[model samples]
Target chain A: MSNDKEWKRKLLRDMVVIRTFEETADKLTLRGKVAGGMHNSSGQEAVAVGTMSALDPKDVIATTHRSHHHTLAKGMDPKLVMAELFAKATGCSKGRGASMHLADVDNGNFGGNGIVGAGVGIAMGAAMGIKQLGHKKVSVGFVGDGGMNTGRTWEAINMAVVNKLPFICLVDNNQYAVETFIDRVTGGRDIAKRGAGFGLPSFTIDGQDVLKVNRYVKEARDRALAGEGPTLINALTYRYYGHNVGEKGQYRTQEEIADWRDNRDPIDRFSAQLISEGLLSQDEYVALHAEVTAQINAAVEFAEQSPYPDLSTIYEDVDSGLLGAKS
Target chain B: MSTQTETTRNTLPSYSEAFQQGVREEMYRNESIFILGTDLIERGGHFAQVRGIAQEFGLERVKDSPISEAAMVASGIGAGMYGCHPIIDLNFIDFSLGAMDEIINQAAKIRFMFGKPVPLVIRATSGVALGGAHHCNSLEVLFAHTPGLSVAVPSRAYDVKGLIKTALRAPDPVIFLMHKKLSGVRGEVGDENVLIPFGSAHTVQSGKDAAIITYGYTVVTAQKAAAKLAESGVSIEIIDLRTLYPLDEDAINETVKKFGRVVVADEAPLYGSITGDIASTATEENFKYLKGPIVRVGGIRAPISAHPQSAEAAIPTVESMINAVKKVLAY
Candidate 1:
C-alpha cells in the first residue's frame, strides 16, 4: 500500500487479470473450447503476480505442469497460449506443445514439464548457463510440495549448492498434493526445513501477501546476482480449485475450504488492505475486474480465429527419426 | 583446429579414436555441447573413451561428476532439455540402473508428452569382456524395449563416428551402445561426414545356405560361424542388426526368403531379447520360407558370473552360432 501509484496500479491490474483469466478459462472449458484441464490459481493470485513482479524479463523460469499462472505473469501472449490450450497451430509451440508443456523461449519461459521434479534440473542447468555466460540472470525453479520427494529434485538442489550456482527455487506449498495433505504426505515436515537439509538458505513466507512474497523474492534475486548461491522460498498458499479443474473433492472438507475462503483469502485480503489504506477505491477495483474481462475476451477471440496445426507437424522438430527403439 | 590436418586425420580411425573424434568435433561444432559423467575428472573417463578430454576442455565443458550416477544422468537430461547439447557417458552398462528413471521417464518421454524433442546422446559401453561380469552384459535390449528411444550399436569405426555425429544432430533421445569388444576394430572409413541412418542392416557375408542374424559383439561371433560354415559348402548370410528398436523386420523377412532358414544369435538372455523377438517374428511372418524351426543362440537366464568359464557359458559362442546354423540347415 505504501508503494507509488503506477506500480501499485500495475500490480492491482495484473492481479485482476490473472483472476479474471482463470474464470475466463473455466468458462471456455465449459464451452468445450479448452480440451485440456487448467490449474486455477484463483485465490492464490498475489503469490504469482507479486513474486513475478520482482524478477527480470531476461531471467529464466522453470515451472510445473500447471504453469499458466507463471507463463501469463512472465509475458506470453494470451492469444497464443490459449491457442495452445485449444491445440491450434497459432500457439507458441504450434499446437504440438500442449497445456502441460507451454513455452515461450523469446520471453525466457522454459517449457513446463508434466513430470514432477523434472524442472528442478532445468533450473540448475539454467543456473549453470548463467555462470558459464557470466550473466546476471538467475534461474527460478518453481516447484510444489509433491516434487520434494523426487530424487531428481534432490540431485538438482545438491548440484546447485555444491557449485554455488545462482538460482532461486520457489516451493509453492499449497498444503495439499492432490487429495493428500502436505503434513500427512511429508510426514509433518516443513518444505523450508528440507531446503536447509540441502544446505540452501530457505525463506518461509506468507504467500497470500503479495508484498511479502515480492520482498523475499527480490532479496533472493539480489543475493543470487551477487554470487551468493541458490535460495529456496517456501511459498505458503492454497489453491481455490482442485489439483486440476477436473479434481473430485473427496478428500478435503467443505468446512476447511470455507474457513480459508472466509479468513485468509489472498485477493480479498489484499483488496481490503488497499481499500482501507486509501490506495485503491472499491469502484475503481470493480472497473479493473471489468477491464481484465475485456482483455481475456480479446485473447479468446484471437485464439478462436486461429487455425489448427497440420499432420506434417507431428514429424517435425524431433532430433531423431528412429521413432521407436532400435533394440 | 584440425581442419588444416583434416584430410590426413580423416583416415579410417579405430572405433575408440573415432568416438573421441566425434565428441571433439561436436564440441567444436556447438558451444552448447558438453560432457558429464563419473571417471571424467582425475581419470579421463571410466572406459578411457573420454581420456585427456579434461586437459583440453577443462572441467566445465568436460564435467566430472560424483558417484551419484542417477543425479548425473538426470542433470544431463535437464541440461539437454534446457537447450544444450550434452553427451553423458555411463561408466558401464551395469551401472546404468542408477540413471534409469531419467533415461526411461524424463529424457525419453519429454518430447512425446510435452512435444519438445530432447536432443541428447547417452553414450555407454556394453557387452561381455575378459573384463568380468559387471563390466559385461549388453542390455541394449532393455533400452530398445522403451518407446521414443533410438538404440544404435556400432561394430565398425565408421559407424561409431558417424552414429555419434548423427545422434548429436538428432532431436530425439539416442542410446549409443558402444560395444567394448569392437573398440579396436578399424576399417577404411569414408572421407565425407558420413551418416548411416537407422532401419538398415549390414550383411557381413552373402551366402545362399542358412542366414544367421545378430548384432553388437555377437555380429563378430556370427561372422566367425559363417566363415566356418562357408568351408562346408553351406553358404551362410550374416545379418548384423546394427540398430535394434525400429528393427529391420523387412530385411529379416527378405533374407529368410532367400535363405529359407534363419538363426538368431545374441549375447544376452533368450527371453524377451531382441534375438527372441526377431526369431518369433521371423517364424510368424516367414514360416513358409523356413527350411527349419528358427533356433536362437543366447546365454542362460541368470546374472553374469565372474568366472571366465561361466561368463563364456553365458554368451552365444561362435560354436553355439554354428550349431544353431546346422540345426536350421537340417530342418
Candidate 2:
C-alpha cells in the first residue's frame, strides 16, 4: 500500500463514512423518513472500500441491491445519495431511484440491481465495450455468494472468458443470502474453486483486512488491463444486521451477530491495525469518528431540506426523445 | 453520410435483405454500433437478417454469442450505457421469453430509474408460420405495454428498411419485430437514407365505408380482405400502424371520424392485445362519431401448434378480418 499518511487516513474515513451512513439510513427508514426498503452494508464496508480504492477513476463497477457502501466508495456524493433515500428531486437519479437503484454513470458506477446476479452480465458487457473501444479500463461486478449459483452469472463469466474481455467478479461471501445460508445451497464448496471450471485464476481472501483486499483487487485489475483475462475473488465477510433493516426473523442468533460485530468488525480491526503500525493514535481515531458522524449528519440534513419532485414533471425522462426527428 | 451501394438502392429487395442493408448502413454511419446474437458471424443470423455484417465490420462489431438470452440482452444494455450501441438479435420472438426480466425490468426501466439514456435495439422475428410453440409467437403486445420501450412491428420490405433505420437512430430502447412470414417477400424500397418515423400510420387503402386498422403480417391479411370486399362492392379502408407503443392516435381518430365504423385486428391473442388499446382510443376520444360498435379481430388465446393448418387457424386470418369489417358495416 501507499506510505502517504493522507491516503491511509482517507481510507479509514471512507469506511467510517459508509458505516455511519448506513446506520443513519436504517434509523431514518424505521422513523418513516426514507421512502423505500434500505439494505444495510454496515459490517461489509471493507470489501467495498478496499476493492474500490484499487480501481482507476476510468474503471467502472456494477453493484448489487445492498449497495450504499459501494456507491459511496466509488466517489458518489453522500448528499445526493441521502437525498435519493429521501426521494428528493436533487437525488443522484433525480429521485427516480431510491437506495436500491443508486447510479452515477459519470462517476463510473453503473448503479445497483434488484435482481440477483443481473449486474454481473451488465459489467461483462461494459468490459466488452471497453475492449471494443480499445481502452485500458477494467470492469468490476460485485455479487453475493448466492448470486454465484445464478444461471445468468455463469453465462456472463463464460462469455467474458471466451471474448477475453477485461473483467473482475468480486464475491462478497457474507455466508448468507437473506435467511438461507450459503452452505445450504453451495453444498459446502469453496466459491473460489468454482472459478476453476471457467479456466481463470481465483482466490479466497480475508475481506476483513483492508490492505489485503486492496492488494488482491489491484493485482486483478492489473491482469485485466494486461489482456490476461478475468479473475474471481471470494472475499469472506459478514453482515452485522439482518438481510434488510428491521427484518423480523430468528434465523441468526444474537450471539452470532455479536461475534462478527465485536470480534470481526472490519472498521475496528483496520483501526487497530493502523494504531499498531503507528499510522494512527487512539486520540486521532476518536476524532476521525466524530468528524465522519458530523459529515453524515450534514448529509441527512441536506436530504431532509430537499424538495420532492414535482408532479407536473412525472412524464419527463420516460424516453430519450423520439427518433427520425427531421424526417 | 451513407455507404449504401448503387446496386442495393436500384433493385427491389426482400424483407431479410432490406433489414441487413439497414444494419449495414447504420454501422457504416455509427462506429459505436454493433450486432450480437447466435449464428451471426459465419452463419449470418438465423434468418440472414445480418448476413454480411461480420465480414464488413469484423468480429468486434458482429459478435456471435452462446444461447444465453438473459446475458445477451443484459450485456447489450450495459454496452449501450457505455459507449457502444448494440442490436441484440433474438432469433425468434418466442425465444425472448427466456430474458423477460432483463428486457422488462432492466432494459425497459433503466432510463426511467437511473436517468441514463439506453440507446439499444432488440431485433426479433415474430408471427406464426407453422413453427412450433417454441418458435412461433406474436408477443409484441407484451413490449407495447412497457413504458420506456418503443415497439416497432414492420410488415413489408419497404417498412422493414425504413423502420429499422429509424430504430437504429432512436435515442431510446426499441423492440424491432420483423415478421417471419415476410422475410422473403419482395417489395419496393426507397433510397438508402429513408427513415420512417414512429407513431405514423400508413393509409394503405382509402374508402368511405368501414376501416380495418392493423400492423405487421396482419397488414397483408387486412389488404387481402379489403380487396375481396372491394369485389363485393364494399370499399373497406386500411390503416397500418407501424409502431405500437407510440401509437398513431391521430390516424385512428381520423379514421373513426370519417368512416364511423372500424375493425381493429392483431396477431396476438384477443384478451389484453393492441386491438384493445385501439378500440379504447376510438371509444374514449371519438365515441360520439361512431356509427356502430368497433369490432376487434384477434388470434385464439392458445399456443400456436406445429401443424400447418392448426397454426393457420390460431392467428387472425383474412376471413376473420373480412367478417369483422362486415359486422361493423352491417351495424
Clashing pairs for predicted structure model 2, backbone only: none
RMSD, candidate 1, Å? 5.0
Q: Note the DockQ of each predicted structure.
A: 0.23, 0.68
Candidate 1: where are CA atoms >4 Å away? A1-4, A27-36, A88-97, A133-136, A246-250, A273-279, A299-327, B1-15, B112-116, B128-137, B145-147, B182-200, B245-254, B276-295, B299-301, B306-308
What are the per-residue Cα lDDT tens digits for candidate 2 across A239-294? 88888889966988889888989998989998888899888999999999998899
lDDT of 1 by residue, B33-53 (tens): 888777776777755677777
TM-score of each: 0.86, 0.97
Q: Please give, for every candidate in the order listed, the TM-score of chain B alone compared with the true chain B.
A: 0.91, 0.95
User: After superposition, which runs of candidate 2 have C-alpha atoms over 4 Å from their true positions?
Assistant: A1-3, A324-326, B1-11
Indicate the TM-score of model 1.
Answer: 0.86
Against the unseen true structure, what C-alpha lDDT does each candidate score? 0.77, 0.88
CAPRI grade, predicted model 2: medium
DockQ for model 1 equals 0.23
lDDT per residue (tens digit) for residues A1-327 in model 1: 355766767777777777777778877776778767667767776777777888998888878877777778777767777888877888877776657778865566767777787777777777776775567888888887888877777778888887788888887767777778877778538778888888989978988888888899999899898888999998888887787775658788888888777888777887787788788899988888887788888888888998888877666544356433243
Candidate number achieving the greatest TM-score relative to the actual structure: 2
